[model samples]
Target: MAEPLSSLSLWPIGNCQVSALIDDAAGLVWGCVPRVDGDPTFCALLGGERQDEGVWRLRLAGQVSATSQYRRNTPMLVTRLEAEDGSAVDVIDFCPRYQHSGRMYRPVAFIRIIRPVAGNPRLEMLLTPMHHYGTEAARTTRGTNHKRFLIGDHQLRLTTDAPIGYIDEGRSFRVEQDLHFFLGPDEPFTGNVAHSIRAMEEATELYWQSWVRGLATPMDWQEAVIRAAITLKLCQHEETGAIVAALTTSIPEAPHSERNWDYRYCWIRDAYYTVQALNRLGALDVLEKYLAYLRNIVDRAAGGHIQPLYSVMGFAELEESVAANLAGYRGMGPVRIGNAAWTQIQHDAYGQIVLPTVQGFFDQRLFRMADERDFESLESVGEVAWKMHDQPDAGLWEFRTRQLVHTYSAVMSWAACDRLGNVAERIGRPERASFWKDRAAKIRARIEAEAWSDEKQHFGAAFGHHHLDASLLQMVELRFIRADDPRFQSTFAAIEMALRRGEHMLRYDSEDDFGQPETAFNICTFWLIEALHMCGRSDEARGLFETMLAHRTASGLLSEDLDFESGELWGNFPQTYSLVGIINCAGLLSRSWDTVR
Candidate 1:
């Protein structure tokens, strides 16, 4: 049960709480609370010397073998433990988001479920929510109609519908059996105990089920697709529809590398492709909201400038800050919030942001609601698109070192102009159409003449560098160049030859790149998937797609990078952008497979 002491992740069907078992031998960590990124309340992940934050353990129980899983198509988590006494305890966990409970940036509901599967099991409940990753303790007490606790700015209110007993530990309390626990911060849940639980569960289920049904994927890989789908939905900040890169912030690319970066904000570039992927899956309700968010941002900027990323609520003032109190993930230090890279201008971001909005507008049937106002907002995007060619700033990677005329950036700049021209021509804006066409033609000419390194047989990462970048592969995807175009073919081949590591492709071979340079970028690999299909290597593309699919973790989760040697997922877990890439690539491959058959 305990392997030199480690952690295990589990999902139980029809349960909402995702449990991470810290000590299987002791059966010490049980009935865990709301979520993974939540305040540990009970965590041994941070430090040691028998120190853990908040945990409810079955203290009287001895060593046990445990397994956990979620109900099919639901967030419910059931953790099963078989004890040394031949007794079994089934902990059913769920924190149902109540009706209209999906706003991700706000404090939300979390449910814990417990049931006796095989035997009458006795359990001890302990609540210890340590502040700042268990660095500080919350003041605790029992209030009328509420078990209230506060630490600095965080206020926790626990309400139980059943009779409960409590003992105060250093941090939280130990509770008796037969109780339903409701845990949330200052943003209160509606009503008390049972009413709140029912509402939250109904809302969360409705939100999730509605999303799942909308996806067009069949049952062949249904569970995998559903898990991936939920992960993607979780990333969307429900209020603004700004899809965060991930829920957690400041997880390092490499342990002790100081390469930590905050990804909670939405990147303009990531949003574009994500929109396309969601559109392909027929998940446009959320996609349209995101597009509207982008529209609002464009209107607000008024052509002054657009950020490469923004906060979940569309706040543009995202200056990076470090949380010095909490220890970094695995000691990869400097847990940061807000991304400084927001100020860096990635020219490709403009096209990536605009094209997806346009594509989603036209392709997804859900966008049948497109009206004159939508088109007007799009015209504003065209005005912003024109700014791409004039700007020379950091390219797609948002590199901190230096800014250059990245060829991929140029390709995207060209794409924005070209897409704007298409939209303008369709909407009868002939003058605007002509202007965009002229700019597009110029971008094409500039890329062919300046971006190509005939001597190196490929396009450069940046103009005159002669180095290949994985992003140049986008030239084909964005139609900056035709798939069979000699330059594009040569560039793709060159990237495969130079940047390819086994079946995976690297972003670029920059020495300054972080994360040990051992893994392929999840997004870049997906780019290769599309590129392979475009270049008529359909079989190879399909094979690589299958291989990448195999790389997903056992729970159908995927991280930002794949360690080639050890095959460990690195960077953030359940990365939405990477999964979006998977959807786009899979949809393309599915189409290709149909064509071949």
Candidate 2:
């Protein structure tokens, strides 16, 4: 029988370096190695009908049903499979991450422990890995207790205690005892495999639980917030402190929309929102590391210019191309590898840099405080924001063929100058504060005159247009305007009437390069919820929040897009933008701690 196709109903496990997606049946479907943006070592999620090639699965003979769940407050996943004859087996999966050798030990490895719990069971281990974007199978070599797969120039070794002959020949065997498998670098295993794996599992669990314990979670929806927060952390590349937008690439925004693009790289705009959301939970570790990444980016720019996105290693050139060998999500063609948006001129990036960097000056808890030298570097970013406030460029949405002075971009530019002024004042640079505040005032006046649509009675998507966009709602969140301000209220009313589709919200109603969008962007819906709460519609906001929460997958996570009509998830898995929305909204709408105290 053929294996079933993959879906968004998957769980994520990572250690801030390498990550993988597992299906309910405990198949390792998607993962990248060396780094998040590296080659897909397990490309089964986009492998189409040929998924049996690039995947690792433990098959239970006569399998009847299966169930899976994450260990509470951690990314460790436990899956149980029951056979027709009442036989069962438990599969515990995780990537090792703990304190070892006086440093954080996070290797690019996957650990699986399988133990039979019920009647005598038979198991078939299918561990076929592919190379070069699923174009060919990985060549294999064997040892006494392990097998090595030559993938591209690198080799991945599978060190297992299971019957090596059975796994090597893809044969079914009796599950008479516990089994352990470690797939990682081609190195010798020193310690006893069983004992080392068990100890790693315990330490990894403790590491995650202790991290979660330190979070200042809200009074309500604590579980949901923690899951989302962990998912966001999984998206970050700790070595570089860069947070990616999503884990997979080329998952269409809608069925056959052809709007697929790679999302493994870090977007300045996305990273800023990620740090802002994590900061609200007092997860300053992420913020502090991200600030370091931001400082490097700003220094490289020399306060002149910055790209919208970059590779996880902070490299600039990410030439876009298609991997025709592998099929896309659900056999959709054209799986993209690198993102072209890295070259687009997204003016909002300046603000994204300044917004998060300014936090370092105010937060006293960070290990390294921002000094005058840091402020000097930030002013270079502010200068660019002031210069580009009204310049036409690609908007945050990255419209390929159009260039416009977008309202969102201009607003962010204004925010850049505005925040620089605050930082200057905090650092006792009153003269610098006055200078930036003046520029901010001028930019605000220009936006008020150009972006506002007099005929539509609302702010437009871009200057001198009457189009409604979900991003306009961000004005309130960015403090560009108060919720009660008449202009903002009118803009909100216009947007609600135009972009709201039942419980979901569209990024914009206007057609784009790919025609009209067929699915709702998840972050846009959360933006509407935030707007509703800010407008004093607490009941409406709470109800809508509940509806959104109900849309999360069994793993309590969401993707980048959703089929508003069917509520099925689409786009990439474990979207950082969507997860950030969960954290921000929960902090906003959850019951106050005073209620319980």
The candidate scoring highest on TM-score is 2
Which parts of model 2 have CA positions greater than 4 angstroms off? none
- The lDDT of model 2 is 0.91
lDDT for 319 (candidate 1): 80
| Ten contiguous residues with the weakest lDDT in model 1 | 6-15
**Over the stretch 1-597, how does candidate 1's per-residue lDDT look in tens digits?**
112322223222212222233333233232223333344454433332233443444332553676766555655555676757765656555555434434432244345544455555555555555665556667777755556777546566876663344324322222233346666654444566666565555666665676577788743445666677666765665567777676555555544567667776788887777667666677776687787788778767656367888876788888877666556555555767568887888777777666866654455365344545666666565555566654567787777877777787778878888887787776677997898899889878887888777797777777778877788887777776789888788888888887788878777766764533556787888888898898899899878888888887555666677766666666654577678776777667665335445
For each candidate, C-alpha RMSD in Å? 4.7, 1.0
* Location of the lowest summed lDDT over 10 successive residues in candidate 2: 1-10
Off by over 4 Å in 1: 1-51, 54-60, 98-107, 132-135, 144-146, 161-163, 166-179, 185-203, 218-220, 359-384, 513-516, 591-597
Q: Which candidate is the best by lDDT?
A: 2
In candidate 2, clashing pairs total 0
